[model samples]
Structures are given as structure tokens and as C-alpha cells.
Target: MSTTPRDRIGLVLSGDVLEIGPGSRPFTVAPGANVQYADRAVEGGRDQNWPELIGQPAGVQAHYDLNLDTDGLAPFRSGSLDGVVASHVLEHVANPLEVIAEFGRALRFGGKLLLVVPDRHQTFDAPRRATPFSTVLTKHREKTTEVDEASIRDFCQAIYGQPPIHPTEVREWHNPAMLDADRLALHRRRSIHVHVWSPEEFASLIVCSLLEGITAWRLESMYFSDHFPARTADEFALVLEKVPFANPNELGRQFVDAWCNSVLDDTAIDPVRLARFEEALRRDCADAAINSLPLQLFAAKHAALGMASTQDRITSLEVELKTTQIRAAEAIAQGKALELSTSWKVTAPLRALRRLFR
Candidate 1:
């Protein structure tokens, strides 16, 4: 029997799962599952995307008062949860790294975190720049608690953010008149797409977060979806595992080594990118392990993806040589076949006469 995408995700998650912002459509990850929910403004919540929720007073009732943006898992004790889920919620939160870290704090050593965020290219955030991993890392490091104004502005402006239509027509765009103090406060409270990222960009951010000690979870797996089992487009999903490590450096280095090894297996990977990722590994050799990592800047595959390598160039040349040799052999065979098909019994005297006439 073929397993569905939901089934695959459900398998990764086990025991005491808390799904944030479940709204109207709560996933059935397990049979007889007592999955708890966390979301603010639960009384009047309704999701337009799910028609069943349209007429309901509350789409999915929140059983917990937990909030990711400010009081991230504050009600839950450390190492209490088996899995933490935040679906389509990160884009709305300003303190994503902090919230993620909070999730890590709440999860047990073998617990998991399932995250799904919008694909900037397919969403109203198309016009915005991918959120910088370094900036978020700094904010996490500083223990930032407030949403930045720049992000709010970008979401509100959303200039030419999607498709070939008029700039103002995008779903993300807000009227300039709505930019007053009270409205901005409400926007900051939640329900706006404030962050944009490609799958690669977000992957880098998550990996960097682990290395930077912003989160205790390591990247277990991730994928970008155009549309399929969920019938949703322009979204990427990630599964993270909370590993037991005495210090961030231990698990971070181990994860990097594994990533580098896996990347080497892919013959198509650009050597330069691989080399850069390896360089990050090397730097930790003589230095303080955690501090040596650039973390937010190209710390993983995404940063390494942007360069060239001698081995890759050599491989390219070898493929070219093989192609040239194949072409030469084909040309020679074609010439011989033409000669054989031209009537092999032509006389020398006829050929001489034809030459004389010319």
C-alpha cells in the first residue's frame, strides 16, 4: 500500500503533539490521537479556506492558551512534548527563531517539530526579498521580543508581489490609509504574511539556527511542494529532531559532517559549494566550535550551492570529451555508410571522364 504525504508526516511525529494555529483544518496524524491545539483569539476564529468553518463560531477550538509570537510554549514545561507543529504560522510571527527555540525547549530529546511555511515565489510575498538568515540569527541571539516595522511595511506594500497583474491588486497589499498606529498594532498582533522565503532560503535559516544555538533541533528532512497530496501550492515543509547534545557544538558539527557527506554523494553538486561548506567545518578545528560557524550566512547547502570547484570542472571536461568522441565515431560511421550506399561498382574511367567534363 502506498502511504500518503500526511501518513508520512504522521509517522515522523509521535506522542503528545501540539499543533499551533490549527484553525479549521486539524490534521489527523494518528489514530486515537489526542493532539492538542494552541491559538489566540479562538472564540471567533474561522478559516475561509475551509468551507465547513465558514458558518461555524470556531473552526477548531483551542485547548491551550499558548502563543508563539510572545509567550512561546510558556505554559508547557521543558522536555514535555513529543512533537511540536507550526503550519503556515511562521510567516505571521515576528519572533520565528525565538518561537522555534521555545518549541525545542518544550520537546523531549527524541521529539520532533513539524513546520510548514509559504513559498514566497507562489504567495503574495513574491515581490519581497528572502528573509536574511543572519538578521534573524542576530535577533534570536539578542532575545528580541517585538516585530520589526520593516517586515510589516513589506507585507503591507507587497508591490507587484505576484503574477503579471496590477501591484495594488495582490492579496497581500494593504491600502495606505490603513497604515495608522492602531491598524499596525492589530497587524503586528497577527494574521499577516510578514516573511518571504524560498525552500532553499528557509532550509539554510533552520540549519543555521541549530548551529547558532538558537534552536536545539536539527534538520531531519525538508521538501518544497508545488502541489500534490495536500492540493496546496507554493509551500515548503520541514521536520526537525531534537537531539540530545551536551552543547550545541556537538550536534551542530555532527549534522554538518553528515550533510557534507550526503552532498558528496550527489555527483551533480557543484564542487565550490561543497568546498565552502567544508571550509566551515575546517574552521571549527582550531577555533571555538560554535563561534567559528557563520551560521546565518550560507552555513549549509544553500550558501555552498553558489560556487564552482576544480573537480566539478574536470568532470565537465570529461563529459565533454566523451561526447566529442561519440560524435566523431558517429560521423565516421555515417561517411562509410554513404560510400557503401553510393553503388560500390563505379568504374575509374567513368570517374576520370566526369572530372574531364568538369
Candidate 2:
């Protein structure tokens, strides 16, 4: 429905709008008053998405806050807000389902939410397995409120970006315990992109939630990377609309009827060409894995040898430190003995006289 990225963003938002976690670059500008909660920068400065040193974007207010997005706009009366906006916010939250529910609470029926998320395959998140729908439902059932250790580990694992990078097999030895400690430290920073999905994967979350009557939002419009062919932008923007009377009975039908007239252009992707692309990708990956294993094993051996050399250097430094401490202790004892002598007492007076003269 929209030709440009900016147009797609503007399509879903209008009137008195509330944008969540518009950290440093909010694209939406409404005719009515706009309010945005500037999210705390992820402190470690590792991830580029939510950075620590970035200056606050225009119209970003620190006062408009949530303890976390889980407490989403409880004070607003039902059917009060015209629109809600969140970009790259859902993945980091502990409970995304609750975040959506809270946003839906304040939005008037027919109000839209503009959600933009990273296309995992295009970002550093390429290595992560797509989160199963069941995992999302599980979090909703348990009412999860804290980021887990497992999530942090996946975020830490280095992944290449789009334009496939040839695998470089470099082996570095890291203690699993130390790595665990590191992951814990990064998690405390709270700037983790915990969930990842392509546009299609995210659509499932919205559609499935509506089907189960868990949420009142339905997919209205979307924009993917193809929309911007001149440049590379990994985020896929979603426009979701909230419908009225969101209960088990009417919610499912409301979602279904809204899409009754939907027509899909199957010609967009030629199935035979798509199949050839998939097969070629799989074949190349399998061949790379087979070729890399031998080199990887030798690299591990080389890394172990390097670790042994470092250990020997550490032991030599420890022995040198012990010898220096012994010599220093002996010198201190000699000075104490000299202070007790009659000659030293006479010298002490001479030293005091010299100090006064100086």
C-alpha cells in the first residue's frame, strides 16, 4: 500500500500517538501531539541497534517512562489512544505478549500499531534459530518478566550479516565457566535483542495470536527490504489494527472476516526458481561444512599450544613477583635495625637539620 519506507511508517500512525522506546531515531510525526519514551541505552555498547552513546532523538521525553514495557499504558482509559508505535522494542522485552496487550489496551478500535523488527537473516542474528510459536505462547502462559541466560548466550554468538561471508575457522580457547560469567554480565546490561524473526515469522505471531483470541490486533499492511532496492534496510515494518469486542467469540471471526477479500500474488515468487535457489544454498552450506572440519580440528590444536605458552609466561611472572617481595621484606628489616643504632640516631638529628635548611 506504501511506496517508500517513510510512507509505510506514516500509513499506520495518526492523531495523538504514543511511541515506545524511540531510542534515538523516531520516524513518526503526527499532526496531533506525539509522545515518546526514550529507552535506556543498552550499556555495553556491543549492539548497534540500541546504543549507549547516541543522543536522544527529537520529541523523545525521559519522563514518559515504563518500569519496563510490561507495564504498558495502564493509566490510559480503554479506546483512548489513536495509535501506538514501537521499533525494535519487542525482541528485548521479557514478555512481548503482555507488551502487545498493554499497547492494545489504550488504542481505540481501528487504531494501528507500527512495529519494525530486524530481519534476522540480514542482521548479526543470522545464526539463531527462528523462535517457535510455542515458545511465545509458553512465555505468555508463564507471564515471563525477566531475561534468561539462554537468550543472552544466543545474542553473544557471533553471526555474519547478509551478503554471505565465507566461514573463517579461527579457534580461540575460552573457559565455558568464564563465558557463562560473561553472558551473565552482558544480560545485566539489558540491551539484548532476545527474540529474532523475518517478516513472515512475525506475521505468524500476529495472526496466530488473533486466531487464539489472545490479542485483538490484525495485520493491516507491511513493508519489507524489497520496498527499498536502492539501499539496504533489514527491518520489516508491520501495521496492525485493533478491532472492537475482542473476546473469544468475536475476536477469531473479526480476524477472519477482515481477510475474506484478501488476494495473494503467487506469481511474485516462481516456485521452480525458488526451489533451485533453496537447493543451491543447502548444497553450498553442506560442502563448506565438510571442507571446514579438518581445518577446524587443526586450529583447535594450534590454539591449545598457544594457551600452554601463555600459562608458562604466567608461572614465570608469579615466581619473579615472589622473589621481588622477599628482597623488599629484607630491605625493610635492615632499615629497622639501622634505626636502633647509636650512629643512626646521630644521623637522624643531622637529617632533621638538613631538612630545615632546605
Candidate 3:
């Protein structure tokens, strides 16, 4: 008897199963067995080929938004699901901690969860731009546009540069209430990235969530490191097995938070420093602010239009301010020269009379 690839994969789990965000491509399961797949679009009366995709002899059940963090896990509690597979899905969720907790609840004791996600290290580094507090606030205000369903699509297209048809269908299933419009808009501006995880960070999140449960949890195995070249860019797979009890890493959690907070604080713009900069400009030249107004205006316009980050706008302003100071200094020098040339003898007699009076 020959074992099929699907059989090899399917053998990893022993009982009832759930797959999250299967998307258009479905995983192959064992023959003559039932598995359940959940997605938002499937629940919304959208056409889905889940039955054909699962391809199990007994067929598969489908649920919409079953795996969402906020959604109640009554379905899983109603019956035991031994396994849950999340593929490239965790990154999109607004609050991953909630989702992980739900997964911990859904799984039976000693069940397994398989997760595949993009490697944060492989993605482009988040941009380093310093923006003014006032500018950031103004940008946030501008983001509160009228909420039209089509507007969401248009915004998506504008940010992503085209309609991402494949991801859009699933993304639309996201409950509107779960999304804070203002926060989402700010996030879109910042970079559609809410979380970037290294392998250690990702694993730590899972382990911490599992500690809330009585079930013991252990990381089973990791797949596709250095061996598969294509996965080097986007994805890595982790298998976590349910256990009796596992200790959550309190120190690790604190460390991660402290590190991230330090990074953000270091990157923040210092208003006091900027004030000092303005004072220096004033002291260096008269009319410094006036002469630099046009450049400052240009930079402000660029920032308003979202063409430049706050840091870039500040740099532009500083350049203009310095130029104004230089021009003012030259004007003062020319004025002093004119005063000296205009009245030599007359000024001397006036100076002698003033000295005699003193």
C-alpha cells in the first residue's frame, strides 16, 4: 500500500478538525473522513467551493467567521474538534490575543494547532519617519471620511495600489464593529501592519495563550527552515501539540513589551528640542521665519497630501529656516556698511558733542 501526501499530512491529527481561512485553496484531507472549514465569506452566502476543495470522502462542513476572536465558540464546545489549522491568517486579525484564546477553547484536550504565517524578518522593515504630533493628529482627523461600502474598497485599492480580489473577499467578512475605523485608518497610514513577529515572538504568543487553559501545550515541530527556498520570503509553519499543563513566560512577555515600547519612544519626536531649534533660528537671523515661510508652506502641503512623512516635512522646514537666517544676516551686514559710509564727519561731530554732554 502506498501512502499519499495528503494522508501523510492528515495522519498528524487523530480526530475532528477545523481549518481557518482556507481561502480559495483548500488543503487535502484523508479519504472517507469529515473536516470543517471556516471563513467569513462562506457564511455570507457567497459562492464557495469548500466541498470540492476539502475533497474528503465524507465531505467537509463549512462555517463563517467561526475562528474570529470575539465570536463565541459554541460550535466547538458543542462537539470536540481535535485539530485547528490556521494558514497565513493570524497577521490580518486586529487582535491576535483574543483569537488565540478562542482557539485554545475550541481545541479538545491534547489536540493540536498548526499555524503558518509570514516571517516578519523577511518583510520590508517598517519605515523610520519622524512626524509632528500636530500633523499626526490632523491626519487622523482627515481619515474620518464617510463610510460607504464602496469607499472601503476604494481605500483598499488606493493603499494597495490595486484591488486585491483574492484577499478582499475574506477581508470583507471582518465584522465592522471589530474594526475601529479611526484606528484602521491610522494603521493604514502607518503601514497595514499591526504586528510583525519573529519566530520566537510568534511562538511566545501561542504559549502564553495556552497557559490560560488546563491543557498542556508543547511546540511539536517546525517545518521549512533553510531547506525550502521559496518559503524563505513569506511563510513558516509551526505545529503545537496540546499537553497537560504549560507555564506561561511572564518575564518574556514583559521583555517583549519593554523592548517594543523603548523602540517607539526612541523614535518619537521631541517637542522641546524642536522649540529650541526655533529659538536658535530666531537668534541667528532677523526675518528668518518670514523668508522661510514659502518652504514651510510647501512642506506642510506635502505632508497634508500624504506625500511625505512628518520627519521629512520637518527637515524641509529646517532647511528653509536656515536659508532665511543667512539672508537676514547678509542684509544686516549691508545696512551697517551703508550707515558707516553715509555719515563720517557729521557722525564724528555728533559723537564728540554727545561725549562732552556725558
Among these predictions, the greatest lDDT belongs to: 1
Total backbone collisions, model 2 = 0
- The better candidate by lDDT, 1 or 2, is 1
Candidate 3 Cα errors over 4 Å, as ranges: 1-11, 30-32, 42-61, 65-67, 124-193, 207-216, 230-233, 246-358
Candidate 1 Cα outliers beyond 4 Å, as residue runs:
1-3, 42-58, 159-173, 226-232, 247-250, 257-358
Residues 305-344 of candidate 2 have per-residue lDDT tens digits of 3565789999999999999999999999999999898999
Candidate 1 local lDDT, 1-358, one digit each (tens): 3254543665577689999988667655655555899886623333422233345656587888765666888888999998888889887776778888788899999888888888787777777877776666667778777777777777777743334443333333355455677656655654677667765566556656666666766667644553244546567677888876556665665566545544544553333435544443443233465455444433445544543455687889999999999999999999887667645445646878899999
Best by TM-score: 1
Backbone clash pairs for candidate 1 read 272-308, 273-304
lDDT of model 3, residue 50:
26
Instruction: Provide the global lDDT of candidate 1 against the true structure.
Output: 0.66
Order of candidates by lDDT, top first?
A: 1, 2, 3
Position 351, candidate 3: lDDT = 88
Please give the range of 10 consecutive residues that has the lowest summed lDDT in model 1. 42-51
On residues 109-188, what C-alpha lDDT tens digit does candidate 3 reach at each position? 77777777765555431221111222212322454222233333333433343243335543443334434665444333
